[model samples]
Target: MKHLKKKKKLLTNDTFVIVPFYNEGKVLINVIKKLKNSFKNIICVDDGSNNKNQIGKHKLGVFLIKHPINLGQGAALQTGINYAIKKKAKTIVTFDADGQHSAKDAIEMIKLLKKNDLDLVQGSRFYKKQNNNIPFIRKLILRVATIIANFFDNTQFTDTHNGLRVFNLNFAKKINIKNNRMSHPHDINKLVSKYNFKFSEYPTNIKYTHYSLSKGQKNLNAINILFDILISQLIKK
Candidate 1:
């Protein structure tokens, strides 16, 4: 008699996707729907949006968490991460609430993370030669930021501000993003450097629509993020 072998379980089943948003209008719903097609555990953290109706009604299998007042993206993401950790998620993904990130790319990143036994896998719009349709000023800002981050952290990364990332419970438990605002990326980079986390960059697709661009960070805000990080570092010293 021949015995049958059991098939491997789907990666999406044990993974949790965290989406942090503030006043995201109708695009948030569409983003959640797209993620739902691939991810079973979805956590949407609304950072005190005045219009609670913006996300509309929550769908089945999706968890919604709200803040009393508007915190920042970092705070919202931390909230979602805490919830997912409490639920015993095997993996966690941080995704932008704007309609720019692709669910397909996230799935691929998760696969790479598991296959290589990596702690974190970050999505890079400029990882390889591809058409991300990035605006000129935004591209310049990211390039400069990447250079500065690499100089200080001694790490190599093509894009510093991309919000798409996948990681396992080890990273989720070890990282604590305190910057609470646009500077959280800097905080993440600092943690990665300090802990020497095993990480890789994956080429991901970014669809920059007018709506997404409008919702993105302003060009000048990059300066403020730098200032915030510098001040935080000074305070630490």
Candidate 2:
């Protein structure tokens, strides 16, 4: 089993974990607690969550940003990234607020980023399946999407839409993310290839709970994603 090497030096003070949230009140608190010790800063962007009342007044020493309107996940993520940059973060790790990802795994991704000097380190679920309960339909969509992304963008990532990723501050700053919708992952992949940034993939475990599966993007969203990619390409052309 491959594991991310632990960095000899502690994570830089400029490293931050960015989590985009939307009505994930039940899980967010625990996620925050789990990750608080690993990174210097934790930025949680609440994307106009309807269940904000449920979140309560909990200050875990991490910065929380709120949006008045329900923006898409992509917008929330971008908001967090911008906040991290403003805070002078040198590295940003994009994490999920739904409790699907483990904080330890996030730390590993950071270590991998430092070890390989990679612009981005993406977590790949396809590398191993140890009690991972990924839905069949979602798995198939990801497989097809990964193939299309690799072929069209000349990239070889096993998991194209994994939210767990670490980005170097310099390369991340160059990314002009215009997609304010669910297709942002596709846009990011395209940008990585276009900029000729060094990217690597590492295995990470994703626990697919029923709540997460139901709340996740449906198969129909793939059409919108494809359309977004095409529109982006045409605009570039």
Candidate 3:
């Protein structure tokens, strides 16, 4: 009875949801509210946003960590991860603040992690039943990016850049993100390959709204990210 109660408690608590945001306005609050329904601990890492007032109002049951300067998503995620570790979070979930990711997916991923006794569960938009709303150009870019990441990282991943992920503390302690920007996804993949963590992909839903699309990465930026990864690889070589 005690073990069952503890297991149920672990599912409801002992999980921290890390949300890294730049300039997301009220969308972030809504995301937090939705996540609160399933998760008790929520960490919001503000990566030096100009509009700080938007998230400043919500503090109940949420940890808001502010970066003095814009360090990028990787840095923000690292900050949140470190905080969660200090809090002794049994499981850590990385979620996007643009309102594109689904909180239900996150909950499901966490449950999958505990149930399967896996180290990590990555969300994939193209894994099973694909989301048709993905912009054709964006989908092409992601497909190309996944191929490149797989070839270099020597691992098969359906979606290389999906933000929704859940991992246990063992994997969390092994993570050290060097790249602080867009190239961080590649860095994470490299780490996963290097450490050989027990992981799997879960089909997730991506809600693409006009606002999210506007905030999405541009074609030129994608090119720059590729260039950045190429240079980083060269430097390592």
Candidate 4:
């Protein structure tokens, strides 16, 4: 029997961070500053924030792209991905601007991605659950959604909705992210399984603030996502 060869590890200089923003002006600034100290390149996509005062004069060393109107997180992410490709980024890390994800965790994810030779790395908040503040109802919904997503994709993933993830440039370019709305995270996982990309997961802390909790998607959105998925499957059939 022939043995499969192990893949090579990723390099530090090849990694870049992408942050999608809407009205997270000050929070976005803080995220960029923290990420700058760790990652070599950082890209910020302004998804048309109406705050004119917060638009100009950002201090962090980041490549900023702005949309005239709010284009949603998916569009902002796509913009950042395009910029990353143009800049010749070998690996791109997607980060949240809501101050939920930590810079230290990002560094660890990058290192793990390199060591494991994975095409994508996802952060799983439920792995340890250091914070007990996560609502029980939300947890149940996420669990059900994760089960459905795994069944459809034929892959096991602990956390399906976490925004903190890293992807290789090639794999990132191959994804057809049509949904410019809240369903992009699920799309990413489905694509990874569909494309047969190598992926891994790492535990990370998700700090929940009052603002973030308020801004988070409602429970009804999960039902909407399920409906969308069902419609998509039907259309394909």
lDDT of each: 0.83, 0.80, 0.85, 0.77
Report the lDDT tens digits of candidate 3 across residue range 162-225.
Answer: 8889999998998887778877778776767899888989999999999888886775677877
lDDT of 3 at 182: 77
Q: Candidate 4 regions off by >4 Å?
A: 1-13, 53-55, 128-132
- What CA root-mean-square deviation does each model show from the true structure? 3.5, 3.4, 2.8, 6.1
Q: Residue 223 lDDT in model 1?
A: 93
lDDT of 2 by residue, 23-127 (tens): 886677888888876665888889998875343477677788899998788899888988888889888899988788888888878878888899998888986
State the weakest 10-residue window (summed lDDT) of model 2.
Answer: 1-10
Judged by lDDT against the true structure, how good is candidate 2? 0.80
Write down the lDDT that model 3 would get: 0.85
Clashing pairs in 2: none
Shift in Å, residue 52, candidate 2: 1.6
Residue 1, candidate 4: Cα error in Å is: 46
* Candidate that beats the other on TM-score, 2 or 3, i.e. the better one: 3
Candidate 2: regions farther than 4 A off: 1-12, 53-56, 128-131
